[model samples]
Target chain A: MSRGDWASWLESWRQQLVLWLESTPAGDFVNTYTWAWPIAESFHFVGLCLLLGTVGLFDLRLLGFARQIPLPQLHRLIPWGIAGFSINAATGSLFMAAAPFQYLYNESFYFKATFLSVAGVNVAVFYLLFYRKIVPLGAGEQAPWPARIIGGVSLLMWIGVMCAGRLLTFYRPSFRFF
Target chain B: MDPVFIWLEQTALSVWVRESPSMFAFPGILTLHTIGMAFLVGLTSAFSLRILGFARRVPAPEMLKLVPVVWFGFFLNLVSGFLLLLAYPTKALTNPVFYLKLTTIALALLAVRALGRRVADLSFRPVRGWPGDRVLASLTLGFWVVSVTAGRFLAYTHSRLLASDF
Candidate 1:
């Protein structure tokens, strides 16, 4: 529970993770092939667009942008957003596997993870708590304050996730301590 | 071309874009570019999906209001993209992929504009008509994929980093 204990634990885990990941097939594929990295990066960009397009637009509607689109109707696009998220998750894991240290201690990566978590929790809350409430509302009707707040937060969180993700390379951590 | 790039690169704005330690410089501009891509491609993709019958309950007309937002995304990218180009005139100017990216973006913008009209008096049924809705939707999606991919490839494909390198 002390600072020293936590630091040591992190240090050991980082070493183990790096060692394990370096030996992975995903790691080998990425490391062996020249095109692997760029290919994955391309897919990652596409997936993010898909996500922001469907889900982000829905979020905008909830925030009263283009209020004419019915909430329930617009909700249909969430599945595509899920598909986009799935692609990114797969490619993102590959990236992290290929170069574990690039992300493990990077401040941008940490911020990205935090924003991703916030977005995830925000989605759950929207569906469980606010989704059904907005369902009955028809075209041009304004969403309740809760829905609007959730929408605003969702947008901000996604934008945060994106900004953090984009800044990952700029904030690559130094391994001098190791 | 090299002379112009050299001149541009030597400008204070371009220098800051390339060498500044501030996050608002290259890092922030790139982040803004990503956000623009998300919104530009995102809103249009949403509209395109609706056109493709992904969301049947939603009236296609209701979604047209968001087109301006899509344009807003394009505007953001245009400014951020120019700033990016300003930062590295030689890198982009020297690469064939850069031209591909610009052309692809131009095509994609056309597709977006055409879709606007095609969806104006839209119908869901398979009607034999001029520039089918599904076709335009598919084109928009396809053009975007190419543009986004080409945009990413621009980073790796550039042979020259600066005019001075020549």
Candidate 2:
């Protein structure tokens, strides 16, 4: 598509999304309640902690940070991390619905979303390609280079997500193109 | 307290933390604070869950290696949190919820220490843990949740934005 066509298409899509989200009760709860925003924010932080704790720790183990931890024993913690991710997804969607324009137009939101995707894909790659290799390695064994790289990527991506999420409020997109 | 806030607010460091245009100022520090929080609470909670029988096969003593990292996280938060307090003295000190946040942190710290001592006791061995360790772990988790809630509420509950605002 031409540049102008792309921009117009984006504009129309954004407007429609805003119209749809504005009607959702998630936005209404956020807009109408006094404590709703802060509470959601708290839960979001909690979820991030849980994710970092289980999944992040597992990453650290893969990177050979805490070598004393048995890989399978530590892998048990992944479920809690999944739960954390679910909580964040729910709250994060609620936030976008609450103020669609704030997120859709913000550059930081784009970066955050990209980082989240990288983290997600990185997980998939680890489980599909690298899981079997790490399963046999007992405590204090060095993880292969592939696992280490994946762990490093996961750590950096999550940190990037957090940084971009924090900066979202600061970057209000003043668009002349769209 | 008001006089103390007024004086602290005008200090050069406080001024820089509050008004610096650099992202390294308020935004960077807040981000660091959050990262510290994730590591500190996350690692501790994971350790606690293990003791609570969530990950039973993992030997308890080996997990003690994580203590230093948890303390490192705590150190990061302590420094960042202090800088944040310096930036907006009255904003935090005046809010009752701020006090609540502090109290919860104190309680959480105590719970953490107790839990750690119990875990360390399990060193070089694996047993059911100390008699009350499960209760201690549960309390630690609860305190962390309360602390996190209180910390988030601090932004919304403060009546004063700056010492000078009053």
Candidate 3:
């Protein structure tokens, strides 16, 4: 689709989000849940730390650091990583729910969401495409070249998500532009 | 405090950081600051959990080996953070939340170092039945999370934009 077509589609999404957001009262206690936003934001950051830390460690292993550690042993950390991701998704939704138009229309937020989705898909693809062959290969065996490539791509995609999320404030979309 | 602020503002790097017209001057530096935060906070949390015995199978020392990478991320954030402060010394210096963020980071770093040394002590293997490991792991994760969230709040809670305003 052309850029214009994509923009139009995004605009429709933004409109729907606006309607949903407006259904709530402007002074809704949920919006002003004094403790809630900061607490949720904290949880979100915690999740980011967990996700990045565990996943980054695994990627480093694939890239050949801590060669003595078994991949399965390292993989044990993945569940905690998933827990962190769950926290972020939950908190992120609250932020959007509180101010849908601000985020839905924001270019950086859009890019962040897009990158996150790509990273998620990449993780799924990594497991679906290579898990069985790699897992049975066992401890001390070098990761297959394909798995290493996947690991590298996963790292890049996550870092992209981080950068985009960080840059969100800088690229706040003008509400008037819509 | 005023004199100290004045002296800081007079520093050549601070002057450039505040006065430079290039995007690389302010906005670029801010972007780097946030990226560094993600890496630093993220890696710290991960390493903390590992140190606390979250993954008993992976050798604790092996997890400690990631320290250099975490430090690299920390350094990136430190430098970027300083640049951001230089750009608006008054903005950060006057903000209670900014100070809280700094203090939180300091505590988190200390916790990481202390935990790292403990984890490195090859004699200190995990006891199968003891809950010490789990408690330590939870504390490490908790501290890093608090630090990151406090850091995020700095943007929202600053008291002043410039010295002149105050």
Clash list (residue pairs), candidate 2: none
| Ranking of candidates on DockQ, top first | 1, 2, 3
Error of 2 at A128 (Å): 1.0
TM for candidate 3 is 0.85
TM-score of each: 0.95, 0.94, 0.85
Model 2 lDDT per residue over A84-135, tens place: 9999999999998898878888889999999999998999999999999888
Off by over 4 Å in 2: A173-178, B124-128
The runs of at least 3 residues in candidate 3 whose Cα sits more than 4 Å from the true structure, single-residue gaps closed, are A1-10, A24-30, A137-139, B10-12, B15-23, B127-139
Worst 10 residues of 3 chain B by lDDT: B127-136
On the 0 to 100 scale, the lDDT of residue A104 in model 2 is 86
lDDT of 1 by residue, A1-178 (tens): 9999999999899889888987889988999998889889999999999999988988888888888778888888999999999999999999999998898878999899999999889889888987778878898888889878888998999999999999999998787846
Alpha-carbon DockQ of candidate 3: 0.59
Worst 10 residues of 1 chain B by lDDT: B122-131
**Candidate 2 chain B: minimum summed lDDT over ten consecutive residues — where?**
B122-131
lDDT of 2 at B60: 71
All candidates' lDDT scores? 0.87, 0.87, 0.73
Give TM-score values for chain A, per-prediction: 0.94, 0.92, 0.86
